[model samples]
Target: AIQIAASRDQLDPLLLSQAPGISFKYWKDATQLYLQQIDRLVAKGEDAKLAENKPYGGPVFRKMAVQLSLHDLKGAVTTLVDARLFQEAYVLSRTRYMDSLAEQTLRLWAHDCFLNGHYNTSSVCYMALGDLSQAAAALGKSSDEESLSLAADIAKVLGQTTFAGHIEEKREFIKSKKELLEKLDKQVEDQDLKDLPSRSELVIKENNTEKSQLEEPEKDTENAKEVASTDEKNLMSDTQAEESGKGEDENKIEKLLVELPEKMEGLLKDGIQNGMHKGDGDTMQNGEATDPQNNNEILAKPLQNGSEPVQEKSATE
Candidate 1:
């Protein structure tokens, strides 16, 4: 009847009570046999379909239950750990006064969660393990502001002030770093805005440069022509002015030549009249005729002596 019930998947407390001679050792063996049979039948099914069915009322639970009933705490914990039910394994170990097993399970679970990026779960496991620094470090790895804040509060409540302070400092550092990045982004945007010229202005400047470049040779040629024309005009005007000036100079020289002989004859006539008047006065004062030849000889003697003749005074007394 027990074998029939185990085949029918009816391994309950009532069945065990009805069969008082059957121990948990026999029950564990029967359950494992039934699980093996179920696995063989489900082997051809898809993995999802097989996972959906709890073989033999969950192999881990059945084995753990059997081990617990047999007072085999270590076996039960081992069963839970093999099933990857770490939290339950730790709890069972702790409740059974297996301190070393509980700590070992917790550390294993924490490292597993940490390696799998389950930072919050790892943090809780580390906290349960009394490793406040690792717990805070795990929370820091989560990069969730609210989770870190909550962890800081929990740390404070647990009297882990230093870890709580470290968590707060890390949060502040992250916030400051975020603000600094935002400020740098804003500065970069502003600088880009300042450095970028308007499209129309840039186009216009490019066009102007192109047009100026294209027109330079033409403008240079026109300028050269204009300069040549101006230079020719200036040369013509300079030559005309020089010719007119030369003609005026020649006219002045001709006029001076025409007046020079007349001027010299007039000077000689004036000198002769003054000398004749002096000779008449001298003749009257001496009561004698003064000859022109003697006057000529007197003027010739003063010229030879390079001196002027002394004038004779009239006797009035």
Candidate 2:
């Protein structure tokens, strides 16, 4: 808890080892040594003189933190506001849930900054306080178009259309820029929506292709086995047919060898018969055929004719 308190803020240290009289440097122009008079008055319980030179000062921070711990939040916040440390004042006011007091202090801070010519800070304070009118008015008095355009949007939201229209007309370039940015944002959203479905479709197609590829290897393996089996059957049939053909050819050769001797003997017998017939043909040519009937006929025919007996002439003669 002590560390948390010590670490709550760098400027607003939650815990301080020194009191009002034992101050450290918080401002540049004045140091604790110069404010020793105020410390002496605070130590002596002289409350009136403690705020003599300055109503709220750097030397009183320790006392303020002490007062906050003691639940004197109202006094602490009031003292912080008088010290012109609105940030600290606002923090205490917000933490303590003093809504009315916070609102008052916020307006006061904006008003103070505006009077001090810190229009941008004043605009921011007004924005934080949700006073869009004051924020737009304050930004209009400054030179930043973007922040002014933002204030114009707040004004539009609050139904200050005239102010919004005037701001948009004054900063036409900024208006066009904002429109272009809005157009780009919408286009990006539409493109993203379109890509969503295409991405899913691509994933589905890739998965289908992968599944087919996985199944094709198995199919190819089966086809290869079938082709191999058929090739083996054809090879075996071809081998058997070749062996049978060789056996048939050998049988034909053996049968031809066995019949060749008989064929030659038959040829020899026919040749001897033909030679005998040819030898008989020489006698037949001399008109000396061995037929007795032919000889008788020839003699009778000569006797009956009662002429000279005709003699047969041999073909050789």
Candidate 3:
């Protein structure tokens, strides 16, 4: 039993060796038999005696309940129902702390039974809990009593009595949908099967790309070296001259920058404070400023020869 519980995923031939009296040849078969026997005892309403057989029953049933919770309802319901029966048999002795959990477990068990098309079992479960609404609801009966003239549709359906089979059909449809969904999920998984690249192969590709990009620059440098080799004397002379020309350009730029602030300050002060003479009032026409005073200050600033002077400041400066 320990081996069966411990290694549910793996084969447990050791259970057969351990419990030689029983046919524990297959773990699945063994567990199934154990479950069936408990279910039978619960059905017979011998729940008190069933609970007394704790050595064989309690753990098996508890495991089964967990399995059902994980959606293995078909495999687990036999034992789960028995466990509920056992709990009911000892309801008075059962811990107050565990009452809600037991009720919730029974409710889930009822849902599983209904989902598996055991509506009679579901009805029994709900009836035992005194949940008439759910019991009748499971049976396609009305939750509320109504006057004959204002009867619920469920009452009408129940009166006809063919609706009992409809619930079974719905259960079967749910099973089929579950199977279909399983197949589709498997198909999706199969479709997305991936072959991951080996780390060494990925590393090799990355290293090759890096090497190629590095070699490209080296190749261009080599080409430049070869061209320079072919015209060594001319290359050397041209390089020296180019360097000298750059130095001269830098010096000239420095001189311009040094001279610029004084030149700019003088020009701006003269332009703003000392007004330029107009030729004559008649020489100018319309509303325009006359003669050299008519110069556009903003445009004229740019014409004063700083290559990249900004417009607004140069105008006001």
Top-TM-score structure, candidate number = 1
Q: Name the lDDT value of residue 274 in candidate 3.
A: 42
Return the lDDT, model 3, position 213.
94
lDDT of 2 by residue, 1-317 (tens): 23332232211223332223233343321333334544555687864743334223356676686676566878888888888989889987998799998988999999999888788899889888877789878876654577667867877888989988877777776667878999999999998877445788999999999999999999999999999999999999999999999999999988877666556545544654464466458667865544445443543442222233443432333
What does candidate 1's lDDT look like per residue over 228-249, in tens digits?
9999999999999999999999
lDDT of 1: 0.74
In the order shown, what is each candidate's alpha-carbon RMSD? 13.0, 18.9, 25.9
Models 1 onward score TM values of 0.39, 0.35, 0.24
Candidate 3, residues 139-175, lDDT tens digits: the string is: 5522222211122233344463454445445555656
Worst 10 residues of 1 by lDDT: 302-311
TM-score of 1: 0.39
lDDT of each: 0.74, 0.68, 0.56
Candidate 3 residue runs with Cα over 4 Å from true position? 1-90, 93-122, 126-161, 191-193, 215-317
Q: Which one is best on lDDT? A: 1
Which model, 1 or 3, shows the larger lDDT? Answer: 1
The ten-residue window of minimal lDDT in model 2 covers 9-18
Better of 2 and 3 by TM-score: 2
